[model samples]
Target: MTQELVAQLFGKALSNPILDRMDDAASLDIEGRIAFTVDSHVVSPIFFPGGDIGRLSMTGTINDLAMVGARPLYITAGFIIEEGFLLEELVRIVASMRDAADEAGVQVVAGDTKVVERGAADGVFITTSGVGSIPDGVRISGSNARPGDIIIVSGTIGDHGATILSKREGMDFEVELQSDCAPLGRLVEEMLAASSGIHVLRDPTRGGVAATLNEIAVSSGVDVEIEEEKIPYRGEVRAACELLGLDPLVLANEGKLVAFVAENDAAIVLETMRASRYGADAAVIGRVAEVESSRPRVYARTLLGSRRILSMPTGEQLPRIC
Candidate 1:
């Protein structure tokens, strides 16, 4: 069964000579400054509206590397399946991973598989680790954001979380919602090409934009202020969140990214992002400012012309919506 699963992964899309060797470890020929990232996906329904656990695991790790201004090169996957899981389902998941990898131009160089007792695990869980090469002279980090930097978000927020919540609760909204689960390597590259002044790049996944910006503020010792009206969000998703008593700012997003760039080059970066497929809805939502207190802060100016503190999420609002 393990061998069959491995063969399925290597199906037409993924053809890597190193992976075909079936070795305990993959021999990579990468050099220069490299970025390594690992992520685990355990969304409740292994299959979601726009993606599955397989695609999530792959793109999540790939996005992690891209966040640090790296070009994603290869990824490795590890899967844990519960007993009695259908072979057809596994094949479907593997196909999703292949398609994502192919789209991102990355190779799945190695993997591991394990099966457990029926009640011991979910239908399936996936862990992915990715390697990427950072270009020369590129420097990006959470702590790199500085006062006068402009903040831009890739697209509409909360789509992924809303889609998952709607699916799990069986609540259908007036408009269809799909998870923004996409590989963002290409988008990051374009942003890099547009500006060398980019200081920070982040994918708002689990805690969404609020959490990510808060982390950046603390790390960089800067205060962030954004206009609530400027942040892009689908009207249908907002309505759904209001109906469900949830906050869209804290919702998860799989494909979107938040970039902190120098004010001088903000226009070009925003232009570059808006030109990309995943970043069509890109908007400059805010700016970083000198911190007033020893502890940095994140503030959102509401549509009512009032300021409110955007605090870090204390607990997981939606469990396993990754």
Candidate 2:
């Protein structure tokens, strides 16, 4: 298109001081250690119940940086639009990205766009990258979960996964299911201030809570035991999973995070998380088992009073639902 059209798209909605000043390349002032992350969004249908691909890309990248205890600061986006894609839709997506970035308190500093042949790519795809500052003494990692640490999930699981599934299947469940896509950077900052005993922080994204917990268990050389009843889920998500013969524990969550906090600080962290905007429904669902080799990597104590090993799905349960 012309310069006028491009300017109208990002001129006001996403304009920022750093971005406006940086014509060719972005320059910087980053203090302390920098946490960098990138993610691509190609979720099926492009637009979903709660968010579109643009919002997903922004939140996904920001959350990745937050998982490592970072204060998100800036973001870069790369977009690929199909040949016949409407310019109006493209502008709308750009506006959505700006709104998400604003909510996360980050600036969209730069971006690139490319148009491909008709049917060459999905209607639109976006790749987002982010950078943030990690405070000194904050060293969160997947391998830091220690025995006696309680596992806490930020909020309801399976909402994003179920929403995509319902929309894909054209099933209008009695209760409307919506994607829980959001930015978690602010939540992480509050959590760290509440307690310095946080060992690990992970957002259950593609592989869901089960995969994240199991990965942490293996990485930390410990076993995990989650009480099924304690796991949070909305009624509509539960019903959607039941109808599809799916397990909510393995479903993806765009907004929620699972943290491994020392037992002494678990209560404080839970309270802090519940008080945060993105973590209002936070709950402690499990703990790291002291005995490493005695049980499976990750297992759940079912409501029926039995434990079952939570294995990774042999194949993709919900493909392209990210």
Candidate 3:
């Protein structure tokens, strides 16, 4: 049924030349180069403390394109509604999506709708595709990180994952926890403007910072050394992870970004990110290094003066976490 639905919905090639391939999103070659990215949200329970699937779908795709150094322009959303879904709930989701797109200064130019059998689908699943133009002379990719490049994170980690967990299990903590879901095109633009030497940009999503760093290390063929003390995390989040037997480093974050920049430009890039709305808590957490023969992999220096491997997550720490 899922396969059939996917074929029925996206099987037809898009009319636009750039959108015909049925990729994540459509890329158009206008006067400037453009990039597109799409993401689907099936977060369990749909609504969480700080965000819902609607806003998450929008922000996820927008951040994907922004990670490539593009300025978001437009977005299209498609919602699959279940047969018994509440109309009021649907309206609220749409309203949230609208508000998120508006905050990002992107338009919802087109969309589609479909209803499935009550049990065949979840309450709601939202898919959003975003289009953005890449400024001339700006280039960013996971493979661009080189030895000596510095790694910086936009803010404290684990907020989204911890928040979702708290809501899912009905656990109460002293401090409020909210999903860090947010669009980051503006922050990316500022980083680009600050320096053209920005090497790699990625938002740690599904597998969190650990997975993201592992990907970069393998892609760039370099080792990453992170100072454990430098990686920021809220006290509540850390305590929650300890209680839940989870690693904060492997927790997902929606409004966070990981950037690899030239060592010389690291200070300016950090300053630029800190100035952005989404990056006020940004910090340099690590550096790229030559792959060591003994332990040529991602590692973190612990507060105890020992090194620990920042390995890829074994499995879904939190399923339907996005």
Candidate 4:
């Protein structure tokens, strides 16, 4: 059964010579400064509105590399399947992974699979690891934000988490919601072409924009102030959050990114981001400034002209919301 399953994945899913070797460990060729990251996707339902666990596994790792201004090059997937899981579903998931990898211009170089008792595991869990090459002169990091830097977000936030919550809870809305899961490598490349002043790049995933910005503030030892009205948001997603008493800023977003760029080059960077397919809704949400207190902090200026500190999220608003 194991051999048959491996053969199926090799024939229909993975299309790489290194992976075809069926070796315990496949050799990889990496050069220059590379970014390496890994993430596990145990999202409930296995499939969601716009993506599935397989696609999530691929994009999640790819985005992680892209967050550091890296060009995603290679990835590996490890699957844990429950014994009674349907073979058809497994094939579908692997196919999604292949499509996502192709879309990101990356290769699935290796993988492994294991099966456990039906009740011991869910349908399937995917863990993905990726390696990417950072271009010369690129120095993106969370701690690179500086005073006078402009903060930009790629697009609307909270789409992914909101979609997952609605799906898992079997909630219906007038407008359907979908996960914003996607690969951002191309967007990063385009932004780099626009300006070299970009200091930080991050995908607001688990803890959303609020959490990511807070981390950047602490890491860069600077304060961040965002205008609530300036932040892009989908009306339906925001409404969904409001209905559930969830803060949209604290919700997860798989496809969106928050970038901190030098003030002088902020306009060009924002313009460049807006030109991309995934970043068509890019907006300048905030700015980095000198710490006003003994420590760095994040603040949001509401539409009513009231300012409130945007604290780091204490926990996931929707758990297993990859």
Candidate 5:
């Protein structure tokens, strides 16, 4: 049955008969260093203000590969569809995926589909795996942050999480909030070109900027300090976060990135990012520091001349948020 499903989803191959075996894994031949990343999207209401699962899946995977200074090339998607899922909605998703892939200049070379009993799955769950090539002389990682490096975020935070929460909870806000679900490869490319000594590049998804910074601090064995006044947040998102007792820093962001670069090149890098479509709100929010304590920590400076520790999220503040 699975073989038949595969045949229906992907046509038969002529060269390799083993391809018809419907194996769980697919092998690929490679040359230089390759980067691979996988992500699953289960955003509530599937159809949100800015995008759906299909576009989110593509962007998420592409951005993951791009964060490490990799040029994304291809993606493989696996879809789990509910039995009663609407075919029209599925078509729309596929179209959106195509559009996203085209915009990213990546090919959807492979994919799979499976149907589950109605209640067993949500409307649809998308898993995307992407492969990209890392350019020579480019090294970027979470552990590369150094003392005196300036941190810059691509854009405003909490848009994606706020949009999802509003739609899921059916709360009407004064302004229309849209999710910042966007591809960041181009933005990363611009930043890399403007400066070569980029210490780290991280997309503040899942647990948002706070969790991302904490992860970087621990990995790089350095202290990070951010001024709350410098972090950008939309008014509507701020109001929503207040109402829900959520910190905007802890909310998820899909279209934002945190970059660590040398202090001298920070302004040029920020200018490059600001010129790009995805990074208009780019700002130098923080800096890396050598930790004197036992473990690395993230600290935020408030407007009232107070400091607070930023830690990883304890529990799911919001569920099914991409």
Candidate 6:
């Protein structure tokens, strides 16, 4: 893209003081312990029900930092566009990215664009790197769960994954299913303030809540026990998954987070989460079971009073649902 075209394309859509500078690189003065993460978005239908690739890129990056208990600060986006991609569509995606960044209170400090031959790549793919500052005394990680820690989900699961599946496969259930794509920085901050005993904070993305809890269990050397009836999932998402022969537990989520907090603080944390904007349907799904002699794992109790092992996904259930 020429200087003028680049300016015309992004000079205004993603214009921030630092981004508008249009220098070779960006300089940041982030302070304290910062959480830095990088992610790429290639969801098949670049523009899904709730958001586009641009919003997905920014929100996913910011949420990754939020998962680590950090307040997001800055992000850099790189776009790979196809040769025949529509300029109008490109502008819409950029505008989505700008809106998402503004809502999340983060800056798009730097970015790069590349055009590939026709059919060389998807219509558009975005890669974003984010940086955020971790507040003092707030230590959250996938490896921090303990026996008796309570597992709480921020909201319904499988929304994002199911929405993509619905759009990709042209399955609509009359109810418009949209991806739960939203930034959770403020939500995380609220939970942290409610209690310092939050042990684990993880986003159930590609592998869903089952994979995330299993990871926490093994990493923290504790067994996990969840109730099937307690896992919150939307009606439309469940319907879509059933139609698609997909497992809701294994579906991805973009705006959902699973938190493992100390038993004493569990109630307060869940209450705080419920009060947050993105946590209206928050539910306490399970708890860390007593550690066994073997490697830690996850187990789910069915509504019929039966228990079953919740295994880690041997492979991807649905590729590129992020």
Each candidate: RMSD? 2.7, 2.8, 5.8, 2.7, 4.4, 2.8
| Winner on lDDT (5 vs 6) | 6
Q: Would you list the clashing residue pairs of candidate 2?
A: none
Global fold similarity of model 3 (TM-score):
0.88
Model 5 stretches with alpha carbons more than 4 Å out? 1-31, 170-175, 318-322
Model 1 over residues 1-322: C-alpha lDDT tens digits?
4646645554444557878877889999987999998888899778888998888998899999999999999998888889788888888888899899989999999887788888999898889999999999999999999999999999999999888888775554545888999999999999999889999999999888999999999999999999899999998789877787788999999999999999999999999989999899999999999998768999999988998999998777753332
Which rank order by TM-score, best down to worst? Answer: 4, 1, 6, 2, 5, 3
Per-prediction TM-score: 0.95, 0.94, 0.88, 0.95, 0.90, 0.94
Candidate 1 vs 2: which has more TM-score? 1
Model 2: per-residue Cα lDDT at residue 98: 87
In model 4, how large is the Cα lDDT of residue 252? 87
Q: How accurate is candidate 4 locally (lDDT)?
A: 0.89
User: Using alpha carbons, what is the TM-score of model 5?
Assistant: 0.90
Where does the lowest 10-residue lDDT sum fall in candidate 3? 10-19
CA deviation > 4 Å runs, candidate 3: 1-29, 169-175, 294-296, 318-322
Highest lDDT scorer:
1
The TM-score between candidate 6 and the true structure equals: 0.94
lDDT (tens digit, per residue) of candidate 4 on 135-228: 9999999999999999999999899988888877556554588999999999998999899999999999988999999999999999999999
Q: Please, what are the lDDT tens digits per residue for candidate 5 over residues 1-322? A: 2435533433332113333444665565555788999998887889988998888998999999999999887777888888778766876777788778778877776677888888999898999999988878889999999999999998899999888888875555555899999888888888888899798999999989999999999999999999999988899999888787789888888888999999999999999999999999999998999996889999999898898888888777753333
Worst 10 residues of 2 by lDDT: 313-322
Model 3 lDDT tens row, 1-322:
3435433433332133333455665554455888978888889768987888878988999999999999998777787878778766766677777678778877665567778898988898878887899999888899889999999999999999988878774555445888999999889988998998899999999889999999999888899999999998998899888777788999999999999999999999999989888999999999999998654489999999999988989888843422
Please report the TM-score between candidate 1 and the true structure: 0.95
Measured with C-alpha atoms, the lDDT of residue 155 in candidate 3 is: 98
Alpha-carbon lDDT of model 1: 0.89
Please report, in order, the local distance difference test score of every candidate based on alpha carbons. 0.89, 0.88, 0.84, 0.89, 0.84, 0.87
